[model samples]
Target: MGKNYFEDLFEKAFVYIHYDENVESCIFRASCWLKEANELYSSSQWMSSYILYLRVFKLVYIIPQRFRISKNASYYNDLLQIQKNTIQLTERLTTLQKRIAVMHAFTPIELSHVLQLANHHDPSTIFLNIYAHNSSKEYSFSSGTVFLDASFIQNNSLDAIRTVIKTPHQAHIKTAICYSCDNMLDDANIASKIYLSLLAMGITPRFLDLNSPAKVGKNTISISPVGLTNLGNSCYMNSILQCCFACSPFVSLFIDGQALRSLNQNNPLGTGGKLTTAFTSLSHQVRALQGQGVCSPKDFLANVCSIYSEFDTASQHDAQEFLNFFLDSLHEDLNSSAGKAPLPELTTEQQAAKERLPMSHLANIEWNIYKRRNSSPIADLFFGQLASQIKCLTCQRTSTTFAPFSSLALPIKDTTTSCTLETCISAFSMQEVLQGNNAWHCPKCDVPRDAKKTMSVSRLPSVLIFQLKRFRMIGTTHRKIETSLEFKKRISSGMIVPPSFQSSIYYEPVDYELFAFVNHYGDLENGHYTATVFHNYDWYYCDDAIVQPVTDFKRIYQNFSTAYILFYQKVDAAN
Candidate 1:
């Protein structure tokens, strides 16, 4: 027989009897005996080979009779093949069986005793032989076969089996089965009784794929992130909400009751805290049933539409624009500075002197002034400062001003087929010469002159948002850019610092790790939005009410042309 004859036979048997625990166990035992019979035949041990072949025949024959397998069943054909092969071998070995039995000391009585002892042996010591064709290594039963114990099968410990199958780097495992089987031949009547009991309970066997996601039990609560239901063309809203939920600090503000307490109900700019209450309620609903089910954000959507009537219709809107408006609404609703007196305005000379101060000092002073009027959790979390400098070409005068931004909108170069996030950041900070109608009115030159404008990061936020400018307005229609953009899992502060501030000693080193990102498919007229978020040490793709584990990170990040908005959270430099 060929070396792979039994392997191929068992593979077919497994496909047919996969769902039945009793039949699968019977086939597994038959395959072991057939392999031994073939080895004995190869060694010219006719007596031993005949006895093993009889055992294989009995195992296969009982599967059909004991389980009442019908002719229409898939495994019935494989069982007939087993019986035919066994009968042919028996006929050939019959003449030599008596002659070899007298010459050899391996009697059937002695083999029966050995089988009885093996059946009584401890199951913990039994191990399956796993062959990895790619690695050319055999994994002992400890790594992937621990769940094959009779206790595990009886107790229906599918979670334990799932955990072992999900162990990292086990995808190369080709075959795993017990090398020894003794219980089948020890006491046939007792074994049949046990198989019948298992069938009565409706407990079936399960095959595992090492690369597959963990299966959720009927009664088990899911640990995966919950998905949001899309109400009409609300994918833009759903995608941004998922990204925000992935941010621990941002979600904690609502989940921990901070947002409720900080609600500025009296402020005319807010919804009398109604929007905040609706958002907090939605956050709680998502937290309670994450991974377990999907949540309907209808009430939250109503609150949002109440504030922005443009989102009332079932039409697609820009996700970046939605995110900006959502954050602004939340900031206003929870703004602590609401109803507070406004700060005194600064004089023109005072403002000019403040700008003339060191870049670091000017950034801090401006940030403090901005915070005096816009104190909120949103401002503290997502807000960052940018310094814009306009230098006159005719006169050597540089005017610098600092402004706060919720998100950095980076322009993508249409000339390039592919680019990196660092390249986009560089392009955003690079100097641009304003000319013709776009010329800057230089105060020092007292004329509209061609000047150089440069923008740079003056202050970093706890959460940094990047919106890639992929849509362009050409004539009356908006065209989408399909340039592939590659981004890193972690970015250093050096990549974001402006060229002018690279040597500044006051700048502190920081690192940002990507937590979530939103992707847009199709064109501006008919696009779908989705979000890939990192939650609980794994990445998941969320598209409205559908959520699935992300096994291939490369497909989502590297050279991904659909990535529209990315969310990065601040991390310690030491990390």
Candidate 2:
């Protein structure tokens, strides 16, 4: 037989599986790796099985050391030995499973013994192998092989099934029969007798036929670099999904296995529930994919349209707008706050006085208090604080107010050639004299006065998202800025500090590295959105469902004119 597609990969994994020794803190990851190994082994994918087994072997050995309880050190040591022995036994049995893959010549007694041993280890665990071969048909099984569908299994009946050895019941017998396979060499009379005995024991067997080939190969191509099927005009949702999931923290949240449970436990209503569902599916899909995988945001788009009627139309919408709504929905569900609370009620006179008070004064108090009280996981990680300092030229008094922002909106300079990202950031934090109608109302002066108004980064987020102000309204006509922008791999917080605060660089300087990009192609009225993300140290461009690997970031993105949003992660924070 010719070598299988995964044959070479399997050999590499087998070496690691046999000899691996490393320790890590996360026990959940070890457990998940073991589960993946077992599942792959059962599915007859030896290459995936080999890879996952090695992962489990390394992770399982580390579990004992991960425990910090000094008193239970010996106990953990003993537990490790038990697990090691179990894995060794499993590894030996894996060899047997491979040998039995094309076991047409096996006798009834040998077949029965193999099935009994496999089932003996764990009743719930399934170890599958092809029984016979027929050149004419694609799928061929033994004459009396019982096929079991997953839906037929019930949670309540699990106890009866688990107690098969000590207290065999109808459930146990049926489950075992469903998991069994019998060859043509087995006596028909004996098979009939076995069937009769099972019937006498109140166990009835159900079967579903299989049509797939016996010695099947993996779908290495079709499964990955997945193309998403567009549902109407869902490119907006698609683009957002690509960038969000590609984020390392976001991917870790799901793979570590807490985010889904949190979302499911606190199942919010309407769009929240649907968004949760979509994330749940996305998380699983991301984990399950071996390489680059295809994704579709049809469900996510449907949920968005249901909540916001404007999205129901096929017309394109702003990606940033959709991102805000998506994050807000997630925040409502995943935020640290127990739930949303109404603003405190004020007396008639107090409300009137509040309206009279300068908006910045109220914002300095209420907004800051509110932000501290309701710090969400998303907000805590992604929200940056902006300080608006208004210095009264009349009294030499300065008023500093803060507001939380998810992304920084920077204005692009009208340059023919290329503009640097640093320059755009510098322009954002530039100080301006607010005179005329735009004058600041200083409470110290009790009147509108000319003031130096400057906005600077008070606090930086782990992930910094920058949105370029590309769409400009020019007398009922929206125009797109075609100014080419070039971004470096690393940038300092000094670039975003106001010119007046240039001395601030002497203090601790925050360093941010490029992590993701949202590129807008075409014009303002009609444009397509795509994302280029850095994941697992490689760059991949995701356009809707189609994902293609990119080698050189500078070659593709350097001086790109259509860049809309650039995502950066703090080097220290990312670490």
Candidate 3:
């Protein structure tokens, strides 16, 4: 059968296999169970999912034990009987129950008590044993796998107190009412108090189903929203902010107020106070969501309006342009006076000696003492180096210069034909002839001669940003390049950097995953800006305040939409 068939059977709880089955057969069963557990987890069925998850663990335990025992014998033959003695099924059940209890942070005694009274408990509360292995070699079991690493409950268990009390609408309401009544509160005060408690825990109260009654404290809304109040014609800014929030390293810095605290140093841009505060506040609001749901950037927009007067206007602007300006402003604010500290006073003899030098000599002396430092956090995180190689054809002499780039502005070669992101990138780094007025001035030849020039990456950043030059000046009118471009989920450093240029640098090959991208829907003059950002391990399409969870990969990779800017984060080595 196909994987889907097995998955459907497991999801319906129709698959049944005896515990005494062969090791391979048991493994297949476990795989099916694991799949269902994952599906349930995705749907927020925490309690039932954990029960199935434990069953898989119980089944997989046979693998290690089978290896430890005699290979010639079956797993059941080796572990089930000891000295021709049959191990009771109840004994195996007790062991599994203990492990499950530990995984759920419940006492074995309490679990046994609950298991006996299954009819009395709710459907979700009936956590029962699903599997029991034939293993006689008694070993301690704990949640030792790397799975569920992203769980809010870090101990590889559900919060029993919260799960038991907050699950099912009626029970939740009872708990809320009891707490209020215990405080000697009135009926009028109970609703407000309960609402505040849920809000304090970052939970939104919503109906479990569309047809469900609107009882405030009855149901728990697993997802909370960070409502983004859309400023007029500010979808570009909203999209950028959402994508940036998804960047772990970028978000972590400001989320916990570290970036704000570090801003005590010299500001690069003198008028960056509003921008800095806005971004920091944005981070704080997102972090407050606790990786549960969306957040609004009202404060961020307010701050942006205070600084950039153009953004305050009700006009659609380029996302790439805003990103560049934002990064530059941030860099200036954080590191402006980094290496520009006041110079020490010169002695009378030193001053006299300096006055004797020519103006060109004076300029050279000042340049020698100039210290270079990191521009800003944005540059430090996303900035990369590009080496421009210019070779004079006549003299056969070559020269190289390295410059910093926040993002690559790759020009689309043919507007008529379809292109991939790789093609645009290749065109960008491809060697081209610089002839006539565009010739290079060769120092050795001391003349403006025709030369071959190429650009290649010298240093790769942790985050790679790409700006596709879609709009171009055709004759006198500006037109958009209507080329269908394709991009991959994961791209390697080797794909972009040239082999010859890469050798001299400490070029560690990195795999970057496409996380966020801005899409311009429409022609050059008139288009709406939207963004697709990866949040909580899923792709979300954000068009200002209206955000939708995206499942179709094609929606993210639509070539018709003008993919103005792309963000890629280096894949974790551990993953």
Candidate 4:
């Protein structure tokens, strides 16, 4: 077949499928084509099966557009089934092509081309056949074809292939396997180098045990905790960076190269994605170190300083302030709604209706409005809504406003020598009287009057951060609160959300697990910051260039007086 054979076939199929045809007739034709395609697939006729599948998909695509089939209709399901079969068959054909290209006689450049094509689409699985080679004899080591995740191979093609090729052999034995193309000598030497380098770097690929037939190749790479080399007085930045890296979901987006797609270079509020690019490069370097050595964040710091001039100096800063700016900058860089028009203002009637809606619905509406302007992974994971209600003393009317917050700042009472986190949260959500200069201007009564203000968490983020207000100005002197604040490893949303808004706002019970926290020592003016993070089911204290495992929770709990910022991640309800 010619190189353009599939393209030509698809074009002709589209031309033949009548868009004006009846919905039932088109569905029937698609169903028949799908049946034949499945048969051809079963018989291993990939080319013919893919052709029929493409044609069926083309027919099914126009059914809804031309006839507008109702989703509840019986034929709608049939059309859906046909479309699913076609999609599955298309993926199978693509995988088959990749396998054939890999197994056949091909050069390094040819294999690279095949891999490039395979990278465009995601395949469910790929098979690797491993054989053991020794001085005496050579034989198949794997019982059968070994299954591997196609995405893993797509990302780390050479490393994955090397791992699979070296899985069954002992370290002392020199093995040569012709897994790809006819250039066995060159490929084998390359694979050997990769395997040795991987071992030296402490990245052992996970593979199925030969004794376990049902197990599949996971290709899991272990990441070690690599310390950051601090540039003078950069402990505050380093501590926050360590905590951000501890976030699996946030770091994976950069480590896996998925954040690049969402990078908004055109955003005026952002650093033209320069910060995100620098951060991604830093993440790669951190992973490459594999805990064997320290990684310098000079490049990332340079990028940060270019945007925010305050961090350019060699002076210690507040970790919480840096964290807020860092998250906000990343959010702007990756904001999906960058340069997009804001949502129109709601009509008066709509506003009244919105006020009448339930708290959940109102929160969703507010969130949608916020997302239209500030949509990003950072917002999705770290942002939550705070509801503030103000009751007018004169008019006896109340108004509620919803605002977004990245972190909750809780105030510590000076009278308490020892306090619990719940007490702080309750203090944060409690109501207060507003009078004198803080009196509210009543819009309905047209006068300034004393009012009562209440605050509550209306929405919860997947990851939550709490900043303890330890530093306060006491009569023009900066003083630090040395009160011990005790907290648990896990906390429920009920502790943060008010009792009145619990059932109405959150339908399901939400829980948060403490993963990381920043601690400050010494006075507020000249303090050192260190972070303790939970990674891989173990706790580690990260102090700038030093990373150490913490086995004793009692010792860590005793030093809670210096804890400044707490990080929590929402537990998956399904898990």
The top-ranked prediction according to TM-score is 4
**Candidates ranked by TM-score, best first?**
4, 1, 3, 2
TM-score on alpha carbons, each prediction: 0.60, 0.54, 0.56, 0.62
Please, what are the lDDT tens digits per residue for candidate 2 over residues 1-575?
Answer: 13462353233232111112223223434555556656656754443455556545544554545444454554556456547654674654456334333221121122333343454553432222223334322222333233322222222244333233223223443322322233321233323333333445565422211211222221111112244556766677677767776666655555565455565334352244566566766656755675555555566566667777787637888888887787767665665554556567777566546544333234445555667445556666687667787888998666665778889999998768788888888899888999999998987788999999888775667788889998889899888888998756777665664323321211224568887778888876588888777764477777776778788766456524467888887753111
- Better-scoring candidate (TM-score), 1 or 4: 4
Off by over 4 Å in 1: 1-224, 339-342, 499-506, 558-560
In the range 273-317, model 1's lDDT, one tens digit per residue, is 887888889888998884778999999999888877898647889
lDDT of 1 at 276: 83
| TM-score of model 4 (CA atoms) | 0.62
Residue-wise lDDT of candidate 3 within 329-425, one digit each (tens)?
A: 7766665346466668777567646544432233334433432545556666888777676788997766655567789999876566667778888
Which residue pairs clash within candidate 3? 226-294, 226-295, 228-296, 268-332, 268-333, 269-332
Q: For model 3, where is the 10-residue window of minimal lDDT?
A: 142-151
Residue pairs whose backbone atoms clash in candidate 2: 226-294, 228-545
lDDT of 1: 0.66
